[model samples]
Target: MSDKSIRVAVNGYGVIGKRVADAVTRQDDMQLAGIADTSVDWRLRVANQRGYRVFAATPKAHTSMSKAGIVLSGNLDDLLDEADIVVDCTPKHVATGNVALFRKRGLRFIVQGGEPHALTEHSFVAESNFDSAVGRYETRIVSCNTTSIVRTLGALKRAGLLKKARGTLLRRATDPWESHQSGIMNTLVPEQSIPSHQGPDAQSVDPDFDVVTMAVKVPETLAHLHYWNVELSRAADREEVLAAFHSSTRIAMVRLDDGLTGINSVKELMADLKRPNDNLYEVALWEDLVTIQNNELFYAYMVDNQAIVIPETIDAIRALTGLSTDSQKSIAKTNAALGIGSALY
Candidate 1:
């Protein structure tokens, strides 16, 4: 919209896409160039209502969008031509096919977690590797669970207390809106393998991190809750461990004493706070539960699958664009715009 702002276009209008669109618009130095989507539904209409020009992602979608009464602004290439960078939020593996098209225009692009890390050969978590991705062609923002793991463990790693970590995750079966059509009930399903993909993915962001993860799909559609058993470098008091966690703004402490008994309650708390889309973009940990004894630390935290990566993606945008050279500066700007800090604790 102005000569000074970065033009950011979102290539999907689903859970992450729409949120990214809103976040790009809130920034003082970034502009929401437009959003491109193949869906010709209420989602597109909302983008239209919010004044984001809707571009059909395919020629077939172009005609259907008109028949569905969702006005279109040319096609995907048109949106790409106007954007300095594109965040591809299309469904899993779908973004891979678009890589050549983005390169044809020499545009910087970001792909979601469902994409493989090899797609960019660089995975990003704002706190972990923003500097490494600075002025790069692209990067992958690891999945929500991996983002939380990296944020929490990276804090400990930064404090010089981390040794290695083992984590167990209870994952939400599906997004809440689609829970009625999918997800398990009266049953729990576990990943067939130990030390799941999240463990290796965390390595993508920070190769020095020694972590292992196991996950299960639970019956609910609220959020993913993680239980961690970490070996610290030395025997430390709870205060020392908490002090390390306190250093990271993206890691928020929520207490059971505060009635946030689990993920659903945490989600309710975000809604009560009137956060946009009831988004909890931080790692909501139970400060009181964090305990360290004789070099072993145990704690648990909640991760909003749909929201945790939004800030990281924003930071990646700055990193790729060279708009902010320092991770803290870009993180601070993103946190301030998204309300991503400690007031809740």
Candidate 2:
């Protein structure tokens, strides 16, 4: 192990876990420790193909792995005892139990978006609160929506332009596996009992951040879109917000000029890039238009805010854990390195 490297074990080897594992392996200061999951199909096969040590909770998964000529020990504790940090990507219901077990064994834990909506004690974004993550035993990354909204709000708050914020989320439904496994697919539900799970957690960082969310599920399995309403403390011109989005290194604000009417849907936009959350490109903010009833209040176009904010969640994990690096500079550098374009004021 490199002296500066931190060992990280990804607990659930699903879609998110696989992504997390891939990211961890690429970091110079981090090492791919291991992966744990009971699932015995392609996810496990992918992990094995990448040369990560795999731990199986169920005998069936292990037996399947053995049949495939993989040579990993089936002990879960072995992974827990060896790694310095663990990322829990299990579903919300199962996350706490698995995370608590790792904590009991004296391991630092990072909870994925499955984090409880009210858990404000954890830093919401890794990049935004990285310093807070250092030397901490545990931290939670707010859900993707929370992550995206926080970054946008964070910039506004810093600029002293934001007074209140509201959000409308239009979601999509792809397939049963994607929905049951990912949840909130093929369904548009107004804010019900669940509360904007990430919204409250976000406001804990900034009390002025007020958010309202409405979700709609479409037929395609593309990205989520947002329509935002903002009540600014000061009557700011639209150009200011537009400029901020243009200058944000971590955000991608696309200006849908009148001549640019062709890109109306998220599917077309996704096809244009041919990648999911391309370099924190999930978020796109359009120029805000003043309302006729109240010119001071304005509306803006927004895209998947979750993609831009996921790194902040990662940055928070590093900071709260006393991991090396400054949060803000780290995020800015990462964005630049990734060639992500954002407008920051």
What is the per-residue lDDT of model 1 for residues 1-345, given as tens digits with 9 covering 90 to 100? 457889999998999999999999889999998999989879999889999999999999999999999988889989988999999999899999999999888899999999999999999999988889999988988999999999999999999999999999999999998998999999999999998999999998888989999999999988999999999987778988999999999899988898889888999999988889999999999988998767899999999999999999999999999989999999999999998886573
Quote each prediction's TM-score.
0.98, 0.81
Q: How displaced is residue 118 in candidate 1, in Å? A: 0.5
CA lDDT of each candidate?
Answer: 0.92, 0.61
- Specify the poorest-scoring 10-residue window by lDDT in model 1: 336-345
Per-residue alpha-carbon lDDT of model 2 for 1-345, expressed as tens digits?
468777888888765666677666655666878998877577677677768899875567677667766667666777877787788877665786775577678887877666663443665554345665667777777666666677677666666777777766665454224755655534455655444555676765555676655555554444556666777767666666655545445555554552323224443555455444332344555543423234344444444432444455445546655565676666664454344555421
In model 1, the Cα lDDT at residue 86 comes to: 98
Residue 324's lDDT within candidate 2 is 53
**Model 1: residues >4 Å from true position, as ranges?**
none
TM-score of 1: 0.98
How many residue pairs clash in each candidate at the backbone level? 0, 32
